[model samples]
Each structure stands twice: as structure tokens, then as C-alpha cells.
Target chain A: MWRDALLVGGKDLRIEARSRVALAQIAPFGMIVLVLFAFALGPDQSPLVHAAPGLFWVAVLFSTVLAVQRSVAVEAGDATRDGLRLAGLDPAGIFLGKAAAVGAQLLVLQAVLAAGVLLLFGARVVHPWLLLGTCLAGAVGLAASGTLYGALSAGVRLRETLLPFLLLPVVAPVLLAGTRLWQSSLAGGAPDAGASWMRLLLVFDAVYVALGVVVFGPLTEAA
Target chain B: MAPAAPVPAPALFLRGAVALSGRFPLLAGVDLEVAPGEVVLVEGPNGAGKTSLLRVCAGLVPLASGTVRVLGGDPADVRTGVRRRIGLLGHASHLYDDLTVAENLRFAVRAAGAPVDGIGPACERVGLVGRLLRTPAGKLSAGQRRRVALAALVARRPELWLLDEPHAGLDASARGVLGVLVAEAAAAGSTVVVASHEPELVAPLATRAVTVAGGRVVADRATPRPVSTAGTGVADVA
Candidate 1:
């Protein structure tokens, strides 16, 4: 299963490398969201800095939808899905491979967004470790859940509109926990203060990842 | 009395297979049985459930009723090893548009757990050698993409071959190559089922032809004599 997962994950990453969709389109789109948030909140630096964590996560969330959409779109054609099915890899492996690919892409997107937030919003990271951990856990939760919902609505005509509605609500906890964790980390609150939020993110990641792996096979075959 | 020879199990079997699209029944009742090494051609009119039949065999479509067994196991069930031994070439090439032909073949080979060394020979067999292997699938013409898809099929060397409209976009040479590959696969004891509107193109390679209409088999006959492919154009019966 791990072997197949790596094989599929490698294929996705290689495709992204050549397509440059994430780098050229999705990453830029994320940066623009940051700029838009800055504009919406005015030029006052202090308030923007205070709002940086929330705004950054919002951008990540929106960009995550785009990234997840593209990730699933690669397998949009029936032939690709059929090929994946016929290849005989474990369905859980396929789910993990896709989630891992999405997580990897989101990590890069988040890094860029983090840099943008720091430079544009003048936010400081008081405890870099906690912030990093939060971002990692947050990305996993988002990607796992995003992949599950993506497969759920994969072949539907309204997938583009439906994905956001289905995904946004389920992922609300990730956003909330991620925002609080970032706030605590950036504001020099005690490191343990954000531990509970981190735990929530971890739990979210575990449940969604487990659910995705179990249900993905049946869903792909049925869809 | 001498002991009787054992009967070979069918490569694909569907009994009372029923499938629906929304409220409409696509496969009202589909019962098909293909013995090992048999090359069966499926023909039908548009919306006659030909594609659905193949999808059911490939485990892509869920059965609304009845049972389907491919290689002695239910396709609806998650059987990785069973699926690994089957190759399906649908209307879409299934190649990653962003990846080069070589990369696409490599991915397919790896995914099927086939030997990586088979890639070179498979590409050669499909006539996708040289610079064609380096070109991304998106840049290739439709014919080239079909050849790339066929190359992956050759590399995998699956036990069962399910091809849908395998000759739709190919030129004369590619079509001939496809026919030869189908024949060769069956000769090697692999079961081959092809669903094509251009029946003549596949008729020469098929051992039997089954016609599907109104979500059921309308005709089944042995093709003892090969049909000429000359002047055969796409007939949208199905």
C-alpha cells in the first residue's frame, strides 16, 4: 500500500512540476487574496498585523479549494479514473497518495502565504516552532478532508460550486483551531496555550484521513 | 471411463446484471459469459448500454441488481489483485496531459506493478518511439494519444483486456496494429473484449460478436470469416 501510495504521489508531483499550475496560477491567486485582504482592512499596519493570522488562514483555505479542485480535476476524465482503478492499488493508498500530494502543494502555498503575511501585514512570529507545527497539522486536516469531499462530488456537474459548500462547513474547525493556534504562537502567549488547538487539528486530521482511506474505494467505484 | 477434462472458468460473467442512470435503466438485464482466451466484440446503437457493460466488467459502474464476476470475483468488491490483472482502454486516453509519453507509460507500468523495462518495448510496439515519447500527451494529436494509451496496455500485459472504441482515432496503420495486438493478446491466452462502433476494424480479430440494443443482447454470432476493413467508417449504432 505504501509503495502504491508513493508511486501515485510521485506521479501527481511530477505532473504538477510540468504543468506549473500550482506555482503559476494557484500561488499567485493566494498572494492576490492576501493583497485583497490588506485593501479591505485599510493601510493601518497594527490592525492588519493583529488580523494577519485569520486573514492568512482564509487565504490558505480559499487557495486550498483551488488546489484540491485541480488535484481532483487531473483525474476528471473517466479514463484516468478507470486506469487508477484497474491499476489495482489499494483504494486507501490512492486516497493517501492524493491527500499527500495536496498536503505537499498546500505546504508550499502556505509557506508563500506566510511570507506574504509577514512582509505585507508586518506580523511577527514569537514562537516559530508552534506556528510551524500548527501549519503542518492544519495542512493535513485540510488536505485529507478536501480530498474526501473532492471525491464525493467528483463527477457532479456542479462540483465547482458544490465543493466549497460541502468543504467549507466541514473544515470550519480546522480554520478556527488554526487561527487560534497561530494567534497564540505569534502573540508570544505561552506555548502550551496553543496545545489544545493543535490537538484539535491533529484529531481532525486523523478522523478525516481515516474516513477518506476507508470510503474512497467504494466512492470511486460507485461514482 | 477416462476422466473428463476440467472446464475453464469464464474470464467475465454477468448474470441478470442491471444498472441505471438516474431513473432510467441503462442495463435492464445483461447476461454475458466469455471463456478464457476468447475475443468478444460488443456492438450496439447509441445509449444501448455497451459502455455500461464494459464499465461494469471493469468495476467502474455499480450493479443496480444481479451479479457480475470478472476473473471469478465480483467487480463491485475491492480486489486489488484482481483489478491489477485487468486493462481497460476507454474513450479518454487516461494519460496525464502534462506528462510526456514516456512518463505516462512509466506511471502506468509502475501502477500496474509491471516491469519498468517493458516501457521501451511497449512504446516501440505502439510505434511511439523516438521524439514522440518525449512529447507531452496534451501536445500529441488524438491518434498519437491513442497510440500512447495502447502502449500502456501493452506494457501491463493484463490478463483481461477491455477496450472501448479502440480504433476511433487511429489511422490505418495504427488500426492494423491495434488489431494485431488484440489478436496477439488472445493468442497468449488473455481474454479480450472490445466495444467498437467500427466493427469491421475489430471484426477480423474477434472470435465472437454480441449485439446489444435496448439494454440487452440482441444478437450473438461467431465470426468464422474475417471482415474486410476497407471503406469501413464510424457507424454510430451504439
Candidate 2:
């Protein structure tokens, strides 16, 4: 099972690398998103920096979705799907492999976004460690929920449109907690406020991941 | 008592297998008994429940009512091993276009956890070894794609093969290859069921002919016309 996940995960990563969807767009998209936020924030240093966490969370959230959705879509072809069903690899393994691939892609994208945010938008990470932890937790929840949605939308006619609709609502809570954590991290690592949100994000990730283990199988096997 | 009929291994049995679509029973009271080492052909025209019937037998669609058994176990309760014993080749050929033939086979084998000696032999058998060695499936012609898809049978070694139009895109020679492989699989103690509208082709190969219309098995009699008795090929009715 681990072997299958590694193989499929490696295959997905290779596909993304070949496509360059990850490395190419992350910086530009993240920059565009942040620049838009900057424009909205009206170039005021205090306001821009103050809203930096909010803007950062929004960008990361949308980009995380993009990466995760693509990871699942790439593996959802008819032959591949039927083969996977017959292959005897646990469905949970496939989901995990996909989630892991998506998570990695999101991480790589976030790294690029981090540099772009710092350089172009003049955003500073006052709490590097805290910020990274919050983002990782958020990414896990996003990936976990995204895996279930990916499998659900696999063979549907209008899958791309359907994915976000199905996932966004369920992902709302995680994003909310993530946003709160980002706000705290932005407020110069405020000890009291940020800690609780960080804890919430962790719990969100853990719960969603365990839930994914139970639900992803039926979704994958569905038609 | 007469010695049990080589009883290869019951590939599929439906004790009143019923499938309902909306309010209608697409297939009801379908008692289909297929033994091991039999090439059972199902003949039906358009909208005659051929696809639905095959889907039910393949354990794809749930039975609205009735019981279905495959390989001596209830299909619904059967484990992955039982599901693995039933290889299904549908209308699309279900071959991954992006992956090469060998890679596709490897993926299928890995996913299925099926143990086979060598894919090299299967590739050679499907006559895809030369052009298909590293050919991306998307680049292959329809016939080549069909051949590659059909090659799954060799790798799966399934006890029951539910092939829906396995001969559509193939040329005469390719059809011959397919027929031979089907016969060979059945000869090796596998039960084969296929839904086809063309009778001439299947007539020379089928042991029993089962016809369905309006969602029920209307006729399921051993070809009083046997393929062997008629001195053609295997017992099959297309």
C-alpha cells in the first residue's frame, strides 16, 4: 500500500514537473493575487502590512485548491481509474498519495509565493516558524478534503466546475481557522490570540485527514 | 452419479438477478448459470438490456432484487480476490492514452495485485511488442488501442471475462486473435460472457446462446447448434 502510494505520488509529481503548472504559475499567480491586495489596501504601509496576513491566507487558500485539484484530475482518466480499482491498492492509499502530491505541490507553490510576497509586496514573516506551521496545517486540511472531492468528481462530465463547489463549502471551516491563525501570525506572533487558532488548525487537519480515510474509498470506487 | 461437469469454477450465477432502472426492472428474475470453461455469448439488439445485463454480471450495477454469485461466492459479499477474478472490457477499451502499453500494463498489474509471470509474453501475444514497446497509447491507432486494451485479459488471468463488444474496432486478423485468446482463456478453465449483436461471428464459437430483450433473459439455450457439432470454431454466439 505504501509502495503503491509512493509510485502514484512519484508519478503525479513527475507529471506536474513535466507540465510546469506548479513552478511556473505559483509566483506569477501569487504575485498577481498579492498585488491586487496591495492595490485594494491603497498602498498605505500600515494597512497593507496589517492586512498582509489576510491577503496571504486568501492567496494561499486559492492556490492550494488549484494545486490539489490538478493533482487529483491528472490521475482520473478512465483506464487509470479502472486499473486502480482492479489493482488492489487500497483506495485510502491512492487518496493519500494524491493528497501528498497535492500537498507537496501546494508547499512548493507556497515557497515561491513566500519569496514573491516578501520581495514584490514587501511582506515580512515576523514569525517564520509559526507561519510555516500554520500554513502546513492549513495545507493538510485543504489536501485532505480535496482528496475526497477529487474522487467524487472523477468521472463526472463537468468535474472541474464541480470540484470547487463540492469542496469549498466543506473546506470553509478550515479556511476560517487558517485565516485566524494567519491574522495572529501577522500581528507579530501575538502569543495569546494566535496560539488557539494554530491549535484549531491542527485539530482541523487531524480530523479531516481521519475523515478522509473513511470517505475517500467509496468516492474513488463510485462508477 | 455422473462425474461433475469439469465444473471449471462457476464464474457467475444469478439466482433471480434483478436490476431496476428508475421504476422499471431492466432485468428481473434473471437466473444465469455460467460454468467454468464455457464461452457464454449474450445476443441482444439496441436498448435490449445487453449492456445493463453485462454490467450486472460484472458486479458494476447493483441488483435491484435477486442474488448474484461469482466464483461460488456472493458477488456483493465477495472480496477483492473475487472481483479480481472478473475482468471487464467495456466499449471504450479503457486504456490510458498517456501511458505506454507496458507502463499501462504495469500500472494495472500493480493496482490489481495480480501475479503474472511476464507482461512480455502478453505483449507478444497481443502482437503489440514491436510498435507498442514504448508507444504512448494516445498515439496508437484505434485498432492498436483495442489490442492493447484486450491484452489486459492476458495479464489479469481472470476466471470470468465479461467482454462487451471486444471485437468492434479489430480487423479480421485482429478478430481472429481476439477469438483465439477468448477461446484460450476459456480453454484454460475461465468462463467467458460477451454481449454482441453479430451472431455469425459468435455462432462459430459459443457453447450456449443467451438472448435478452426488454431487460429479461428471453432465451438461454445451448446452441442446439453447437460450434463443434457444426465443425466451426469454439462454442460462441455473437
Candidate 3:
């Protein structure tokens, strides 16, 4: 299954290796979100630190959605979708490959935005590595949900318009939980809280990955 | 020369398969048996469930109420390894518009875990040599794009090719090229299932043709079809 997932995901990454769609959407959107975050709350150290958890997570969530969707949209538009299915490979492989591609793209975007945030607002991550972990965790969530939503949207009329509605609702549990978890972790606010939220995120990751694999073929093939 | 090998019994067995979405039934009791190495051309009018049947056979679409078996295992089973041998060609061939032709081919091979170095021979098999290696997929003509797609099968050398309109856009010579490659694939013991409106292309490679209408199999004949003995529009369907 992992091999299959890698195969599908590799296809996406291999194509995006030369394609600029990832760079064009992911970097700019991430940077812009960071800019918006700076404007929304700034000029105070205590407030910034207090707000960092929510602010950072918010930045990660929205930007990742756009990046992930754009990645899947490429697959949706061309023969890539059918080819993957026809290759007689696994759908989970497709999800994983796509999720990983979008994940790597998110990592790059997050790094750039993190640098931009430091430069502009002097807002530095409490533990830079933890923030990276947050980005990674958040990425899995986005990819898991976005891949399925993207599949669903591929069938829906006007996918661009429908994706947000379909995604935001399904994506809330992870976004909210991830946001809260990252905030608490960053501030060292709740180290021993209910592991259920993060646990939920993990379970969401596993189930959604499987769901993406199972549903993607039909979801994409549907009208 | 010896006679062609007889197709083994159907590996994919669907018994009265019915797939429905709420009130709309995509298909009703579709009983299909696809033998190994059999060239079954699935035909239908638009929305007649040609794609639906292919999806079911490939184990992508779910049955509303019926049993579908791929090589004697449940199709919806995530662990069903039957997909490894089945190849489908549809509108979404997954070709990268921005990547070079060679890059796209290599990507498909690597992603599918098929041999990678076969790109050269695969390209040669599809007659894609010299003319369009460095060209981005965005710039390739429609016929060239189909060749790029056909090159996909060459990489895997799949045992089955489930195609939806394989010859949508091609000149007379181009059609002949497609027919030859298809016959070569089938003659090599591959099962080819194509759904198309082109009479010239189907008549040549088809061992049996099934015309589908209203989401059900209307005709299933095993008689030999007319080979492409002449130019386009000359091959007759029986």
C-alpha cells in the first residue's frame, strides 16, 4: 500500500519537479498570509507571543489549503488522474504522493514565510523546530482533507467555488485542533492536556488517507 | 504460423451488478465476464454506463447491490492486487503539460514502479522518436498528445488496456499506427478493452465487440472482426 501511495504521490512530485505551479501558488500565498498576519496583530511583544499560536496556525492552515488544492487541481485538469488509475496502481499511493508533494511544497512555503515574519515583525518562533513539526503535522492534515475534497470537488460543478465550502467544513476539526495544539505547544501553555485533539488529528490523518485512496477513483471519475 | 491462444476464463466476474446513487441507478444488473487476453470493446451512447462498466471492472466504482470479483477477490477490497495488471486510458492521462515528453514518460514509469529505462523502447514502440522528445506537452498536437498517452501503455506493457475513445483524433495513417500497436499488444497476450465510436480503429483489433446502451450490454459477439486491410472508413463492422 505504501509503495502504491508513493507511486501515485511520486507522479505528482515528478511532474511538479519541473512545473512552476507549486512555486507560483504556494510561495506567494504563504508569504501573503504571513504579511496579513503581521498586519492583523503587531507592535507588542506580549500580545504577539500570546497571539503567535493562533496567528501562526491560521497562516499555515489557509496557505496550505490553497497550495494543496492547486496541486490536486493540476491532477484534476489533465490525463494524470486517469493515467494513475489506468496504471493499475493504488489510490492511497496517489493520495500519499500528492500529499507528500503538497507537504514538501508547504514546508518550503512555511520556511519562506517564517523568514519573512522574522524580518518584518521581529516575530521569532519560540522553538523553531517545534514550529517545523507543527507545519509538518498541519501539512498531513491539509493533504489528507484536501486530497479528498479535491476529489469531491473534481465531481462538483464549479470546483473552484465549491472546494472552499466542501473543504472548510470537513477541514475544521483538524484546522481547529491543529491550531489549538500548535498554540498551546508554542507558548508552553499545555504540555499535559488532552492528547485527544492531536490524537484526533492523527486518526484523521490515517482515516482520511485511506478514505482518499478508496474514494479518489470514483470521486474524480464522477460527474 | 500457429493460431492465436484462446483467452482463459473471465478473471473479472460481475453477477447482476447494480450500481446506484440515491434514486438514479448508474447500472442495473450488469453481468459481465472478461476472460484473460480477450479484446472486449465496451460501447455505449453517452451516459450509457460505458465508463461505469470500466470503473466497475477496474474496481474503482462501487456496486449498489451485487458482487464484483477481480481474479476471484473482492474489487472494493483495498488489498486487491488485481489493479496491478489492469491499465486504463481515459481523458486524464496524467501527462504534465509543462514537462518534457521524456520527463512525463519517466515520471509515469517511476510512479507506477514499472521499469524506468524502458522509456526509449516505449517511445520507439509508440513511434515517438526524434520528433517530440524535448517538446512540452502543452505544445503537442492532439494526435501527438494521444501518442504521448499511448506511450504510457508501452512503459508498463500492461496485460489489459481499458480505453475510452483511444482514437478520438487521428488522420488515416495515424489510425493505422494505433491499430498496429494495439494488435501487437493483444497478439502478445494482452487483453484490450476499448470503448470508442471510431469504426476503423475498433474493427481491426477487436476479437469481440459489445455495444452498450441504456447502461447495459446489448450485444456480446465473439466472431472475428474485419482487420484494417485498407485506408480509413474502409473497415466494416459486423
CA lDDT, every prediction? 0.87, 0.72, 0.69
Name the runs in model 2 displaced over 4 angstroms: A1-4, A24-31, A153-158, A183-187, A190-193, A221-223, B1-9, B21-25, B76-80, B224-238
What interface RMSD does each of the candidate structures achieve? 1.6, 3.0, 3.0
- The segments of candidate 1 whose C-alpha lies over 4 angstroms from its true place after superposition are B226-238
Residue by residue across A1-223, what tens digits does model 2's lDDT show?
A: 5776776776677567656777787557876898888887786687776666667667877786677667665666554565555544666777778788888877777777667666665666667777788778877888877877777777688888888888877777766776677666656757567777777777878887787777777766564
Score every model by TM-score: 0.94, 0.87, 0.78
TM-score of 3: 0.78
lDDT of 1 by residue, A110-140 (tens): 9999999999998999999999999999999
Native contacts present in each candidate (fraction): 0.80, 0.34, 0.52
lDDT per residue (tens digit) for residues B1-238 in model 3: 9999986667668788888776787887787787766667777788888878777777667788888886667655545556666666665556778778887887777655678877788788666888598888888887888788778667777666778787776666556666766766777778777888764458656777887877677788874653333343334211
In terms of lDDT, model 3 sits at 0.69
Please provide, for model 3 over A42-136, each residue's C-alpha lDDT reduced to its tens digit, 9 standing for 90 to 100: 66666665665565556766776677677766766674665565455666666667777777777777677666655665554455554566567
On a 0 to 100 scale, what is the lDDT of residue B38 in model 1? 88
- The DockQ of each candidate is 0.68, 0.44, 0.42
Which candidate would rank higher by DockQ, 1 or 3? 1
> What would the DockQ be for model 3?
0.42
Question: Which residue window of length 10 is worst by lDDT in model 1 chain B?
Answer: B229-238
